[model samples]
Target: MRVALGDFLELNLRVRSADDARLQTIFGFWPAFLVAFALRLVGLFKFPFLDEEDRMMRVAVNGLFGYGPQSGQAPFWENLLFRTPLSNSQAITPLWWWTEYVARLVVKDETLSARLPALLTGLIGLALFYWLARQLFPFPIPALLAWLLAVHDVFLWVGTKAQYVESFIFALSVLIAWALLVAQGKWRPFVVAVLASTTAMGFFLLKGMTLTFNALAVGVAQTALLRGGGRRLNFETIVQRAIFAGLIVTPLAVWLLAAQAYITAHYQVRVAELGYFRGIADILYALTFGYGTGRTASLV
Candidate 1:
C-alpha cells in the first residue's frame, strides 16, 4: 500500500541512469504488465470455471444472494466480531465473498462481478512483485523477472479465476515484508510495527493459518535483527525490543483467542465436511499421496 509512484521512481533513479530507467519503464514494465493484463482478461472471459471455483461461487451465492436466514445481512456487530463465515479450511474467505457481492451490486454481471477481484488483485500483486524485485536486484534483471512472471501460464490462469484471490494476501505479505525490511526512519519502524500487528489480524480474517506463518516469519526476522552484526544488546535495548515485539503481537493474539472460542463452538458442525479429514489415516494419506497427485497433474 505504501508503494508510492514517487518512491518507485526514486528507487529506480538511485539504481540506474534516467535514460535507462525510462527505457525499462517503456520497454520492460509497461509492455509486460499490459500483456499480462490482456492475457488475464482473455482467461476471465473465455475460460470455464473449474470445480473449486464452482464450489466457491456456490458458497458466495448462498451467503450473498440467498433469501431468508441464509442471507449475508448480519448485524454490523456480529459481522465485525463473529467468525461464522471465515473458515479454518481452505475455502474462500468472507472478505472475498463480500467483495464479489459488492461488485455484483454495482455491476449486475455475474461473471464480471465474480472474477474482477482476482484480476485486480493479481495485477496489484504483479506490480508489487516487480517493485520488490527492483529493490533487491539491479536494473534489467528486475525487468526481466517481471516479464517472465507476466507470461507465466499458471500465474495468468490464477489471475483470471474467481476463487483465487490469494493475490490479495500475497500482495499484503509482500508489502509487509518490504515495509519491515526496507524502512529507513525513526518513527517509520514504530508505525510499521503497529500496522504489522493489525495486518496479521487482517490475514486471519482473510485466511486461516497464513496469519500464524506470516507473524512467525516477521518475528524471526526481527529477532535476527536483534542479534545481527555482532552488536551487543544492552539491557535497555533488550527491554525496548521486547516491548516492540509485544506491540507487534498483541492484536493477533487477541484475535486468535476470540477465534478459538468460535471454532470450538463450531467443531461439531464440521464433521465429515469435504476437505475435512476424518482421522489420522486421512491426514497421513493427504500428507503423502494427495499432494503428490496435484504435483503430478501440474507436471502433466
Candidate 2:
C-alpha cells in the first residue's frame, strides 16, 4: 500500500494549537470596535464645534498657512516677545505643522483643513487607548474598558475637537508605562521611554503646568516599581539606579529645559494658567458614568 502525499502533508502541518484562545481574542475586539465607531459617528452630529475645537482649528490654520490669530503683532510685552519668536507661534508641537500642511494640500477649504488633523488624531488616540488597555489587562476586561472609553461622550467630544492635549498625553503616557513594565533593562524599552517622554513633553511645552503632574506620576510609578519586592537598594545600588533612571529620562529633561528657556526669555506669564480643574464630580461623571449636555448615564 502506498501512502498518500496529502496524508503526509496533513501530518506534518499538525501541531499544538490554541485555536480556542485565538477565537476568544478575535471575538473580544468586536463589541469594543462597534461601540467606539457608533459613539464617534454620533458625536459628529451632536457637537460639531466646541471651544477647544476652535482653538485647534486656529492652530492648524496658523500652522499651515502661517496665518490667523497670531498673525498681527500684539500690545502685551510677553505676547510680543514670547509668542512672536516664531512668526506663527501658537504653542503647538512642530509635528502639527506637518499634519496641517498635509491637510491643506488635501483640502483647500480652511475650516475643513483645520479640523481634519483633529479627526485623524482622535482616531489614533482611540486606537492607542485600546492597544494600551489590552497590554495592561487580560482579554475581555481590556476590551470592555476600551468599549467604555469608546462611547464616552466627553472623550468623544474631545476627540472631535482640537487643542486638547490630554488625549494625546494620556495615550503616550500609557505606552511609556507599558514599555517600562515590560522592559528587562533592555535598550528597546529605554528608547521607547525616551521617545514617549519626549512626546509627552510636547504637551508640557504647549501647556507648561503638565510638568508637575507628569513628574509626580512618573516618580511615584518608578519608586513603586523599584521598591516592590524585587530589588534591594544600597548606596552603590542607589547610584546605579539613579544613573539608569537618568538615562531613561534625559530626553524629557532636555525638552523641558528647552521649553523653560523659551518661556523665561519672553514671558512673565504664570505657569499656573497651564493647569485646569477637573473636579471629582467631573472625573466620576466621565469615568464611572457617562454624562451628556443635560443628563448622565452609567457606562456599564
Candidate 3:
C-alpha cells in the first residue's frame, strides 16, 4: 500500500510539478510582495490626508468614552449603542470600536491612534491579497497580475490614508472575490464572503460615492459568476441563494438605510454630496492608469 501510494504521488508530481509551472508561480508572486513591501515602507514615512479619517476617529472616540460633537439629546456613547441597530450611524462596529479604543489606551495621541489601525489594516490587506492571489491563480502569473492590480497606485494611496474606507474596501473585495472563486460549495467560504461584503458595505456607508462603485462592481461580479457555465437559472436555487445572501446582508443594509433616512430627515441634505472631481473623461484615464496623472479639468 505504501509503495502504491508513493508511486501515485510520484506520478501526480511528475504531471503537475513541471519547471514552467514552478517558474510561473514564482514570477507571479514576487512582484506583488515587492510592491506591498514598498508601499508599506512608503506609508510609514508619509501620511496622506483622508477626508473620512476624522469622522472615523470621531466615531471611535465617541464609542470609547461616549462624547461626540454630533451627539444630540443623548450622550455620544449612548448614541453609539443605539446606532448599532441602524445601518449608518455615528457608531463604529463594536469590535472595531473596541480595538481602536484599546489602541488609544496605548498610543494616546489622536493622530497616531487613527493612523495605526489603518496601517495595520493595510498590512492585513496586503497579506490577504497575496494569499488570495496565490490560491486563485495557483500557477503564480495570474495571482501576481491580480495582486499588482490590487496594489495599484490608487489603492496604495487610499491604503496609506488613516481611517480611509478604500483600504477596507480593497481588502474585502480581494477576499470576497477569492472566496467566491475557490469555495467548494461550502458554507464557511460563503459566510466569509458575506462578512467581507458587510465590511465593504461599511466602507460604502462611510465614503458613499467612492465605495458605491466598488459595491456595483461586486454585484456585477456576482451576476457574472451566477450566469457563468450556462448554469440553469432555477427559480428555487436563485431564491434560496438570495434569501441566504439577504440574511447575511440584512444587518448592514438595515444600518445603511436607517442612517440615510435619519440623515435625510434631520439634515434635509443628501448624505452623499456627489460631484465629478476628475470629470467623466478622467475615468478613461483612471481606467488606463491615469489617476496619478497631473491633468486637471472641470465639468463643461
Candidate 4:
C-alpha cells in the first residue's frame, strides 16, 4: 500500500511539472514574438533600399510584368520556372520570386512586398528556434535564447530585408530542429524523415542550393552523433536516413534540369529576335554591333 501511494504521488508531481513547463513555454513565446515583431516592423518600411532589396524588387517586378521580347511567348510553366528578369543568369529562387510577386499584387507596394517574406520567415524562425531550444534545454535557457535571437542585430537586419538570408536560416532552423527531434526519438523516424526532406526540398525551391547541402549535412551529423551514444541505429533508421539524404539531393538535381531547360528556351527566343548564332554570340554581337554602328565608338 505504501509503495502504491508513493508511485501515485510521484506520477501526480510529474504531471503537474509537465503542465507548468507547457504553460511556461506558451507564455514565453507570445511575448518574445510580439517584441520581435515590433522591432522588425520598423525596418521593413524604413530602410527599404538596403542590401539586395533593390535588385530583388526589380526581379519581382519583371516576374509580374514579364521579361524580354519573348515574355509573351513563354508558356505558363516557363514563366513559373524562369524568373531571370530579362537575362538567363539572374534568376532568383522561384518561390521567393513568386512570394514577392504575389505580395506585390495584393499590396501594390514593391519594397514592402519584397520585404514581407523575410519578415514572415523571421517570425516563424523565432517560433521554431524557441520550440527547439525548449525541447533541448531547460526553461530559462530557452526563453533567454529566444529573447537573444529576437534582439540580435544580424537577425534583425536580414529578417527585415528583401533577400534569401532570412528564409535560408529559417529553413535551416526547421531542418536542425526536426533532426534533433528524430534523434531524441520523440517522433517516428520515417514520418519525420519524409516531412523533413519535403521541408528541405520546399525551402530549396525558395533559397536554392545552400539549403540542400546544409540539410544533408545536418541529417548525417545529428543522427550519427546521437546514434554513437550507445543506441544502435536499426536498419529501418538507416534506410530512413538514406531516404532523407537522397530526397534532399533530388530536388537540386530536378531544379538544375528545369532551370537549364528554361534558360535554353529563353535564350533561344532572345537569339531569334536578336539574330545571333549561339553560345553568347548575342552578347558579342551587341558589343560589336554597337561599335560597328558608331554607337559605342565615342568611348574608344
Question: What local distance difference test score does each model get?
Answer: 0.61, 0.52, 0.55, 0.60
Clashing pairs in 4: none
Separately for all candidates shown, the number of backbone clashes (residues 3 or more apart, or on different chains) is: 0, 0, 5, 0
RMSD (CA, Å), candidate 3 to true, equals 8.3
Q: Give stretches of model 4 more than 4 Å off.
A: 66-80, 83-92, 181-252, 262-300
Tens-digit lDDT track of model 3 for 1-300: 999999999989877857646565466555666667577657745665455656656454555554565445455554454332122222223334545566687887776665666666776777677666556555655565657654777666655555444566667777776765776345677667767767665544333333445545765576677679666556675577669878877876675456455544554321111212222222323323422345332111
* Candidate 1: regions farther than 4 A off: 1-16, 67-93, 184-228, 232-267, 271-300
How many collisions between residues are there in candidate 4? 0
Give TM-scores for every candidate, taking all chains together and pairing residue i with residue i: 0.68, 0.59, 0.58, 0.68
lDDT per residue (tens digit) for residues 1-300 in model 2: 247887776666552224433543477556666666666556544555655555545553553354675444444333323333222332433444445556777888756665555655566666776666666665557667766777777877666555444566666666666665655345566556656766654443433224334644765577678779687545574467558767766765664455456555544322211222122223223323434464443222
Model 1 per-residue lDDT tens digits across residues 257-279 = 56456555655223112244433
Worst 10 residues of 4 by lDDT: 270-279
lDDT of 4 by residue, 33-131 (tens): 898999889988786584355544655355456663435655646565654432322223355555666777787676777788789888888887887
Better of 3 and 4 by lDDT: 4
State in Å the error of residue 15, model 1. Answer: 9.9
User: How many clashing pairs in candidate 2?
Assistant: 0
